[model samples]
Target: MSSFFSRLKQGLSRSRDSLAQLVPGGSVDALSEEEWLDIEDGLIMADCGGELSGSLVQQARKRRGSSIEALKTSMLSMIPDAKEINTSENGPFVLLVVGVNGTGKTTTIGKLATMFGQQGKSVLVGAGDTFRAAAVDQLAVWVERAGADMVRQHDGADPASVAFDTVQRGVARNYDVVIVDTAGRVQTDRGLMDELAKVRRVISKAFPGAPHEVWQVVDGGTGQNAVVQVEKFREVAGTTGLIVTKLDGSGKGGIVLQLSHTYGLPIRYVGVGETLEDLMPFNAEAFITSLLPEHAVKS
Candidate 1:
């Protein structure tokens, strides 16, 4: 747990700096205008957004015990418990991975492959993003590294076809899980997003309820724009979970707050570093505690 906290703290230095000043050290009898303004500014600077930061500050002002612990509790309240990621007894759990290109979607899939493979689950990967030859090749490399079997086709093949084939293969081979990778289409591209819908429908052609989870991989560095991405994808692809990547490279970790506040989706995992091991399961409490100052941890 200490090692996890250390890595989380290191990855979220930016948010920690802002949050360290956000919470008052001890209980306060009354809220000063300057203090309230400073608290709001710190949360906003951390990228938690104006609405959440303001409401959180307002909550603090209303509480007699607005101590650092109180603030930590308030901050952690925004994130809910994530649903368990596992193979259902009925069939293999299928995860459909979607996002714009460069959001680390494929890398996340690879990490997931490794994570599941290490759990001793036989994993199968479907390279459904056939629009880009590079995309298929990159996913192939990752699946290989994860020691998972891959089902892909030549560049420009119908992505829906690949999804069907992968799910079929997983069932036939009795694999524990199947991860299908989709093209990195901009959310506004109706044609591409609609194509994703087709992939989902076609996936059912193999087996109903096969793609049990739809996960969107968002770039944590994208900040507020990530909200827009989630909104659009949720409407189009019916996103069930999120994998936020590149937190180690960006200070805007507060986007997690906004994401949970608005969408209420389970954040399955987060990528803090480039290695496969760097991708860790999302734990909301640990994340909030990690973003607090060292003094707060000791307390």
Candidate 2:
């Protein structure tokens, strides 16, 4: 296995162990009703939503294969295929990132800027999280480390204005990419969500059809709560994709399946560790292999 895959498997070990106990080496035809029920329960306990777990178990039981192989196929079919972030044919490619507080939204932006820079693309970041000076300061450190440019305003300034300025600068300066970071908000707060909507609108106003992608960064350890966050963010922010972070040693990795199966949104990336290299582009096969036990029943 590649080093990144090794890290992914280790990060998801806790979640895998939760399901492994219920799916020992066995033929699917040999599983008793109680054993099948246990497997479904195991999926639920791993944080796959209850309904999805039942559906996966039903599919697995009806499919002809080793118990583990059937489960893997069922899960792989549920998640939508990963989609690449859009790039503009002309002008800067813009990305708007959103998430609840403490979900590592800022850090994900930093890693993305680095990824783009490594591709020899010029990057500009907008520190639109102006509610906290410390937030901009945190982002500044990462921007400098990535050798990217940034735009920010005084604390309490309108976040939408900051985003507009960033896009305007990116356009006029001929930068290759622009990434805008918004203040973290609780999904239940209507006022804050409205501000987030305004930010998106302002970016489009600055450059027509800009903010090409709205990606939400979610904490992998949040379990079912991550589901609710994604639903709310999609409603107000037009979240097009997901970046799941903090999966290193998090038992709640099963939330990835639940989110994908429920919303059919592509999971763009997963953060398996703290390094710049840990923000891995999402791979369906690697994710499933890391999540499920090997097919132990001999052919």
Model 2, which residues run further than 4 Å from truth?
Answer: 295-299
How does residue 259 of candidate 1 score in lDDT? 89
* Whole-model Cα lDDT of every candidate shown, in order: 0.82, 0.89
Q: Which ten residues in a row have the lowest lDDT in candidate 2?
A: 290-299
Which candidate number maximizes lDDT? 2
Best by TM-score: 2
The digit string of per-residue lDDT tens for model 1 on 197-228 reads 99998887897875788999999989888999
Task: Give me the displacement of residue 229 in model 2, in angstroms.
Answer: 0.8
In the predicted model 2, the residue pairs found to clash are none
lDDT tens digits, residue span 202-263, model 2: 99999999889999999999898899999999999998999999987567777888998898
Model 1 vs. true fold: TM: 0.93
Candidate 2 to native Cα RMSD, angstroms: 1.9
